[model samples]
Target chain A: MNLRILIDRFACRFSAFLSVCCVALLALIAVGLIYKSWPILLEHSLSELLFSTIWSPMKGKFGFLSFIISTFQITIFSLLIAFPICLLSATYLVELAPRSILKIVLPLIDILAGVPSVIYGIWGVLMIVPCIRDHIAPFFGYTTSGYCILTGSLVLAIMVVPVMMHLLIQVLQAVPHELRDSTLSLGATHWQMIKLVVWRKCLPGIMATTILGISKAIGETIAVLMVVGNVVQIPKNLFESGYPLPALIANNYGEMLSIPQYDAALMFAALILLAVILFFNMASAYILKRVTKSIT
Target chain B: MMKHKYFKKLEEQFFFGLMQLATVTILFGLLFILFTILWKGIPNLSWEMISQKPQGGFYMGGGGGILNAICGSLLLGLGSTILGLLLSIPIVIWLNIYAGQYSRNAVMVRTALDMLWGIPSIVFGAFGFIIMLALGIKASLLAGIVTLTLLILPIMVRGMDEVIKTIPKELHESTLSLGATRWEMATRVILRKALPGIVTATLLGFGRAIGDAAAVMFTAGFTDNIPQKLTDPVASLPLSIFFQLGSPFEIVRGRAYAAALVLTIIILVISFLSRLITAKYQKHSR
Candidate 1:
């Protein structure tokens, strides 16, 4: 009996220690990344490494300007494609869709959300890439392989649509039913009611969702890497091939061992990506907290 | 007034039509992608593809199957899921049963998890690589398992936390009033109440771990054979697809699609099964 009590005391202490360890793990990742990249950061001028477009790590030049620009371009392009459609679909689902229709549509979105990114990458390779190469790129007079920023953006847009839509739908639904009824009773048309009442009220929620979508698009690796021609140059146009930060690390991390400062450079890239993603996540969380608090 | 009314009606109809079109696009896109994968992949999938290990020159259309990748993926998923559960369950228990719902520590933990959840898998890979370098650990099954554990920890914890939070406080108080220790309350009462949720969370984390390519790409060095030891390299389905699709051979590309089809089916089955389980059991909880 005394041993059993001792065991119980140990169990309680162990459980608390596990959670504290998890929190420490997050700090460990951040510190480890910075520590690993310290060699490159110490040797290379920070401005030259970040601002210059040249990125031939083979020759020990390591400017990430091209990749950063491309990551932004593709992320913005995908957000442009995803935002309007997601907003409309979400609004329709919240304000207009019949219950019977929602039952089907909601599940479909959930399934899409669950579909793996690697599968999305494969599909992009087969369908979106070819179609862009044959049909879309020609219209732009861009002549090259099908892999380009446009193709990557299109695939990413598809991947993020379900998630963006889900969040927007929830935000829209969370605008109290009484608010909708009040707006309708004010002689506003259904569209007007949604425009003035629902959209206006949920703008912060919408911002949160948009930030989440941007973060997802920016961080997406396999699908974007599969389609984004991954040329180490800043894209002059959407039809041109360009590299992004994640793709650069993915494609080059394996070969870094043979190259000087390559691993450090890639670690720097990873750090940058982590920083951007964490910033967006924190912003969204802050907004979501505010939105939820206000609602409550 | 009549003109304005007509314009309002037209505007509403137009936007609603566009929304409908967007919804259709989402559904159609999903269906088309699924159909295309199955259509292109099914013909290439044979019993050998599922059961046999890849032979030499497999990526160049040589003989052999993706058996190594299939097993590796299962092993990684299973290992991570078990580890993730072991870590997350205690965290969930601590938050609900120990820290209480409104504790400052609970809020911080949840916020940290939210931040962690938003991190991309590639970042995890890089972090894992750094840790591995520090520990003198080579890229192996153990490295992959550790990376995947961190990757899925947030997902598992958050999922199970939400579920545990739904268990009414009255149950906790009543159980405590029965003179049971907190450990007993956690193990017998809280665990039983949240078992289905914990299972769902495990399945969710497992799905994420199995499907992720970026997190395991560096840590789990790809090999054509299953690892005999934790220190050996293991191939995964995502990395297999990534490698195969990168190959120049038409036959290898076909096999890539076949592998993708397999991975997709596994994820779909898991999602469906979890949903069914949740639906079946959640009814009783309420």
Candidate 2:
């Protein structure tokens, strides 16, 4: 009995020791990523990295404002197109669909979430781009040469729908059935109840999903790279070539040699992305916190 | 009042139709995207294409099959998965049982793990790059394995912890009262209860590792030929797909599509199997 008891005590201590170690390792990674990334900014200076007008690496220029502009422009464009569609999708799934169809549809959406970005990129290149240029562009006064912010954003909108739907569907499903009942009882029509009662309660969650979706859209690299027509110069209108920060890193990080500074510029670009992602995460977290507290 | 009710019913129908359309629009949008990938990828698929290596220029039909990549993906996925579980299990067990003693810094531990997920994969790539450079294993498969272990560790730990924590306290107490040693009790009682959960976590980890490209791409580097040594650079299917997709050669791009189609099929199978195991466990419990 004593021997067994002693063994148990030792095991308890061992487990405790291991947890601290894992936590410490994660802490170390966070610290190392930030510290090593310092070399990029130290070499290029923050102002040059952030404020310069052009970002041609071959000429030793490394301004990234245009990339930032493109990222936002594409993201904003994507959100505008994808957000409303996703909200309606969530509404349909949570409120409108019968149980039979709901079971089949939900897994289908989840599977899309797990599909690799590269496949999307492949499809965008082989199928979507050519179709857009040949079919959709001519109708809108666009020539065969046109595949830019609009086309890329449309793909991103498709991508972001799964992400946004995941969040919106969960929150919307969790909404109280009693709330719907009370609204219906109060002489509110189904559509009016959704707009007024269902949506008002879920306004915060929908906003949070929007923020989160934008984050996913902004950080995406492969799909955007395939279709973004990634010229370094700033884009004009929806038809011009441009690059976002992630695409810039992916495209240049491998090819840049002899110039360590250019490599660091990629790191600097990454840091900018790190900042943008964190900013979006904080926004989503903030909205989530506010909603969770206010909902009750 | 009755007249007003009739108009209100008409108004509800009008809005309901629009809302229903909006719902159907996005749902179909998802469907069309899936159809697009399947349509483009499936026609190009062939068993021979998946089993060969890249050899000739784009069209001469082969130097390397995806065999090396398939092998590497399995090795890397399974290898990192095993390493991560070995590394994380001890930590999760220790934290749930003992970490309350440190109490004040417990929150820090939690924050650090949570922050691990938030850090972008690029930063992980950079960190792994630095580590490999320091170890003189620069851009090797070991670097890829080590980097991915870190990447997948958090999910593994959380998954395991959430499972282990659910084992009833009475189960542990009863085993200990019978004079079983800590390891025996853990192996016999606690872990027995947590096994399915642990397996579920491992499968999820595998899925992430297999599908992941960016962090692996940076750490693993890309190669057309297979690695002869652990130190040699190797290509993954994702990177191979990325490389071939933009190439001017139709054959190379087609091969890339074939490879992707195979991968998608593999992942679907694995995910289905994993979900089945987890769902079965849930059913048994209920």
Candidate 3:
């Protein structure tokens, strides 16, 4: 008994230490933010960093709020385009698809996940832009210019399809077989059972997953930067190119000189983005766990 | 009874057809995108093109070869992945063996790691540039490698943590019952069982690092030739593609397509290998 107690005690202590060490990933995030932004902080006071609206990197003015708007506008639009398609495809795959077809479909999605963002950018620039110019632009009275909020939104939606699909498929597949089993066993139609019972049980998990995918889309930089055209202005139309916080840094971080505060403002953006993403992730994880456990 | 059975068969066929169509739509969409570049770009690919930097003239002339860019990506990716793993392994072990059941205490830590993972690679690019300036690393491979370590460490640690946590507590108890030290159990038992999963996590992290362009763009700078020393400036595929696409010339743009295809193929092969490794080990070990 004494030996058993010692063993258990040892296990508990070791786990705790491991937990703390793993947890330092949080400190690394802080280090990353500070290490990148401290120069900006030292150059500009906190108040100026948060509230200022001037963003000339060459002359040393750094405004973060405007980029924040671009980030949200692009993110929300992408999620709108992606969420429905992904949900429908996932719904079909998890609830309705035959296994032979699913075996092929799942790996195809995996292949999509593996494609690099730069390739996506290539598609966007070469195909998407011209399509917009020739097709979508005339309808909207803008021709020959394809880089804008909508293009970013469209490409991002395409990029996010797999991630959202993967997460939603996992959650939807986990919905108790009996919940639907009983509903269907009652002679309810397939669509009706899915709509009324399976969806109701899986709503929280779906919401959590949706929010996580949105946060990821928001944090994206390379693909968006490549295709978004980096024009620095508030977009009056979806087709007009504009910069977000991520692209702003991507375009100017290396070129900016002696502007420590400019760097700090970039950190401010990082901190804001980090905070929003963390909150979304935490909420999503919490909701998923609760949903999964409650039914189990 | 025969009539009713015929209707049921019809219903099954209708539903199966719809599902198959949905499946086809998604699969074809992704495949079309993948093949678009390779189809358009492959005719332009050649050994001469591979040996030179992309320039203003046709595909055959000017600039320099991508020999440097490929080497840079491999070096930066491998170096950072190795460094990040070394730094985080002890943490994973500690959390698995020592944390006991009170993991909620580590919630903030895990949350932090997730935030890092989500911080757009561009944001890291911004921050990495700051550190490079601060330390005077100055667009060198060393700076890029260091920045990538920070970007990838959180992911590696979290992935490994999840795998380690999945090790049944019984495994720990049994190993310790053999009169092994806590460290012995960690080194000899828990880690050995979890090695494949840990390796999977590392490979995924490495792939993410290699495919990443925005994070390393500012820190690594653009060098077209392979570096003979760690301190030298270097370019990567993503950066090369980015700069090429951003160029004013159309020929350069086409070459960008070619390069993008090469990078995608590389990424696809890496991902398939990771999937194979993970699936193979799990199937055999179980």
Candidate 4:
């Protein structure tokens, strides 16, 4: 009995130690990135590095303003395109769809969510880019090389739809059936009940889901990199090309070894990306926590 | 009053119509992607492409297969999945069992994992590259596996945590009442009950690891040759597709479709299998 008790205590302690390590891993990553980028931080003012548009690497100038603007443009545009569709689809699935349609749509969402990001990039190249260049751009009386912000946003919108839809469905489903039924029993129509009761209750969760989706979109690299023309300009219009920060790091990391301060500059980009994602995630988590607390 | 009621009804109908249109559009978009991949990929997919290694100048329309990449991806996926599983199980078990579900420590760990999950794979790759630099390691199979482990660790842990959380408090009490220690109860009862879920979680991580391109791009260092040891550079199917699609040759671009088709099919199969497993095991658990 004594031996068994000792073994159990030891096992518990060991697992506890492992759990701490898991938590520590995130902090370690943040510190490591900051440390790696310390040299560049010392060389340039933070304001200049973030806000300046000059990016001549040979002259030791590294302005990240355009990349930041492009990243925000793509993420915000993609969210704008994705949010309404996901909301309506999720509302339909939760409040209106019959079981047969629900069965099919749920699996479709899972499959879409599981499809690799690179496959999306390939599909973007083969379809969206060309369609934009030949048809959409021409229709708008603008010329493009098929790779531009619009193309990137379209691909990203599709990629994030399933994720956002999945979460929204869960959030809407979490609305108490009693509350929805009571609202309907009070002579309110189905649409009114959904609009007033379900949507009102789920507003926090929906916000959290949107924020989480934004974080996911912001961190996306390979697919966006492949579709977005990596021109180093702040896009003046949807038809123009732009470069996002993830693409900046990915496209230049291996080759940055030859240039002084280049690697550190790239690391600084990664740090910025990490900090933004972490902020969004924590904000969402906090909102989600409040939601769960209220529910429980 | 009647006119106002009519307008209200019209608005409801219009919004309902909009919802139906949105659903159809999403469904159509997904189907169009699948259709395009099949239409373009089927003709290009050949036995030779799957069976042999790339010949000289394969990217420039040379005659060779992506066997190196196929093997490399399989090796890396398996390596990272296994490593991720080993690390995540303990963290999850601790979270569910030792830390107690609502404890502050458990909550903190869960939040950390959630943040990690949201961090992009490219960032993980960059971080891993920095770690490799610090450790005096090179871009190789080992490096790629380590980076991918970080990428998938949160996924696997969260997957298992969701399952383990569903195990009732009554089960825990009953196991303890029978004089089983916490560790033994975790292994014998909790692990047994969650086996199907654990398998599904592992498969999910494996799929993510295999399909990811950016996280492995820098750490894995592309090579045409298959890696024979952990230190050797390796190739992957996603990178293969990326490189092949970027090629100017029509023949090479077709192979990219073929590769994409293979990857898509693998992911679909894994998702399908996990669903089947959950359905099968759910009968016994309840």
Q: Residue by residue across B68-170, what tens digits does model 1's lDDT show?
A: 9999999999999998988888888888877878799888888888888888999999999988888999989999999999999999999998888888889
B230 in model 3: Cα distance from truth in Å? 2.2
**What TM-score do all the candidates reach, one by one?**
0.98, 0.89, 0.87, 0.99
- Could you report the Cα RMSD, in angstroms, for every candidate shown? 1.3, 3.3, 4.8, 1.1
Tell me the tens digit of each residue's lDDT in model 3 across A1-296.
57755865665565556546545545555677866667777777777765666777767777665677788889999999888777767888888767776677777677677577888888888778788878997887875478878889988988888888888888888877778878988987786676678778779988998988888897888888877777766677788887877777677665456564665666677777777777787787788778767867
- Model 4 lDDT tens row, B5-65: 8887888898899899999999999999999898889999999999989999888888998
Query: Where in model 4 is the C-alpha error above 4 Å?
Result: none
Number of the candidate with higher TM-score, 3 or 4: 4
Q: Please provide, for model 3 over B34-133, each residue's C-alpha lDDT reduced to its tens digit, 9 standing for 90 to 100.
A: 8788887797666755776534443333554565667788899899999888877766766556544337655556666666666667667766776676
For candidate 4, chain B by itself scores a TM value of 0.98
What are the DockQ scores of the candidates, in order? Answer: 0.75, 0.50, 0.37, 0.82
Which candidate gets the maximum lDDT versus the true structure? 4
Candidate 1 colliding pairs, count? 0
DockQ of 4: 0.82
Candidate 1 runs further than 4 Å off? A1-8
Query: Between 1 and 3, whose DockQ is larger?
Result: 1
Q: Pick the TM-score winner.
A: 4
